[model samples]
Target: MPVKAKATYESVRDAVNQLEKEGKEVNPTNVLNLTGGSRSTVYKFLSQLQDEDTKRQIKKPLPELEDLINEQSTAIITSLYEICKHRAEEVVLTEYETMKKRFADLQKTAEHMDLIEEKYQLKAQNFELQELKLKTENQELKEQNKILKDQVQTLKEQITALNKIINKQ
Candidate 1:
């Protein structure tokens, strides 16, 4: 099986920027397709992008204009409002997709962990069986050793008895 690529914020951010530059809608699915990253990763970067945009907007001072330009200001504000609304929708969809993907990844990880735990349990059981076999063999060897020692003692006693009889004769 092919290893999945690790996703990074920079990669997702670049992909989203590229898509935006190409006049494509910056949503989680599109970013995921472009960057080949999980929905969560792409959405994270997109959220960062949105935060940066918001901060920039907050910091920017409104442009001073003459009374004659009031009509242009209203048009500009309307356009900005539309853009913000669209961007908000994209963010919402991206978040939803991210949550879905994250949940899926968690499930896969959980399943994998369960498999690993099962393998370890089997390994532990095998080790315990081997240990038990070794213990039984050790006990058998000890019993055999005791029997040999008793036989040696009996042979020694016989040898001493024979020596005494031969010396008397």
Candidate 2:
């Protein structure tokens, strides 16, 4: 069962890129429609394209990709596949996760600061109330001391007058 693929690999690659640029699904059917090729040939081409893109993403030649590309006695395709879903989507996911973690850390730090602020605010209010109470108590004690001194002075004067009268008699 030989593959009677009339469309060249370049045409297939161009079709996929155009479909992706238009924000369309880069499946075999769409690719087939754009490139006007046999369904089987489109499938094979799409698979090869995805593999090469994956190889580039890993930044090294993968054994699987080598085996795949080698198995194909046809031309070696090094083109792009959703914009190369395995590669592009992975990059997007990595960036998204990094940002999410950063956001969570900042939220935790903010929560800690809020707790510290609340603790200080409550303690300062309590200290201010305690200070006010102490001032009122001190004023009352001073008034009582003045009254006691005046009573002691009056008692001394009365005792001295009585002593002088007894001596004269």
Candidate 3:
């Protein structure tokens, strides 16, 4: 059997972080080589990592000012809140899509199994029908054989009587 790929979020994230630390570009092939993850898994997690980086950049704290204005601080906080909310929504959407795809795949597998089961049932029924037909044919042959044996016994009795009469004459 082929070895299953271990491609969890933590594994992919760690691989990407490690590659970045080594000043290497984080791509599907590099991550696969480093983490032994499949291309699809690496790509999926890479996109998530990119999204996280984008969210982190967007939520970066503003530089301290000598004269901090209350309005500017409130506006910055509100902006950060909005960015966080948007990123959260995007994450939820991604999870929903993934779950939907998994459910669909499961449904297809169940349907395939049902079809296979139906075919097996049909074959078993056909085998039973054939067995019944053979049993009936065997019974008919046995009855015919019994009738033939009875007729041969009657002919032998007649021949014995005729031989006795000839001997007397």
Candidate 4:
């Protein structure tokens, strides 16, 4: 739609630039008001600008933006889109790799925890075995002490009997 005939391209450009300078998103309706043109005229001017930008991109092409603009302008938007897409893909791949490495580290940490748990279990079992051995040894020593006490009592009784018999004689 030759936007140049209906609206002064310069005016539309100035309005859009002014809106940007004011920290506002340039809308077609605002551009129409700024340029004193109809909404359709504003849209045509925007398309024309997009077309020029797209045309400037002859060396490279972008796939997504190609669908948004005409084929002739596709080359321009395409090149820019390709550059942006390339950078975006690189950032995504780097994040994905970092996540994978962190996951691997977590897996290793879990394995290390499992190893520590096994060591603790083995040490606990060894402690229990030592305790059981000490208990058994204590019981054996008590039994031996009882037997010695009984033997000492029996020998005293025999000595007393021999003494009485000798006194009788």
Q: Identify the leading candidate in terms of lDDT.
A: 3
The Cα RMSD of model 1 versus the native structure comes to 11.3
The sequence of per-residue lDDT tens digits that candidate 1 reaches over residues 86-152 is 9998999999999999999999999999999999999999999999999999999999999999999
Estimate candidate 4's alpha-carbon lDDT, on a 0 to 1 scale. Answer: 0.80
Higher-scoring candidate on lDDT, 1 or 2: 1
* Two-way lDDT contest, 1 vs 3, winner: 3
Residues 1-169, model 4: lDDT tens digits: 2223346778888878888899988888777767775776777788677667655754455576664565655556577777886998899899999999999999999999999999999999999999999999999999999999999899999999999999999
Where model 1 places Cα greater than 4 Å from the true spot, the runs are 1-90
- Expressed as tens digits, the lDDT of each residue in 107-140 for candidate 2 is 9999999999999999999999999999898888
Number of clashing pairs per prediction, in order:
0, 1, 0, 5
Rank by lDDT (best first): 3, 4, 1, 2
By summed lDDT, the worst window of 10 consecutive residues in model 2 runs over: 73-82
List where candidate 3 sits over 4 angstroms from the true fold.
1-68, 165-169
The pairs that clash in candidate 2 are 81-84
Q: lDDT, candidate 4, residue 168?
A: 98
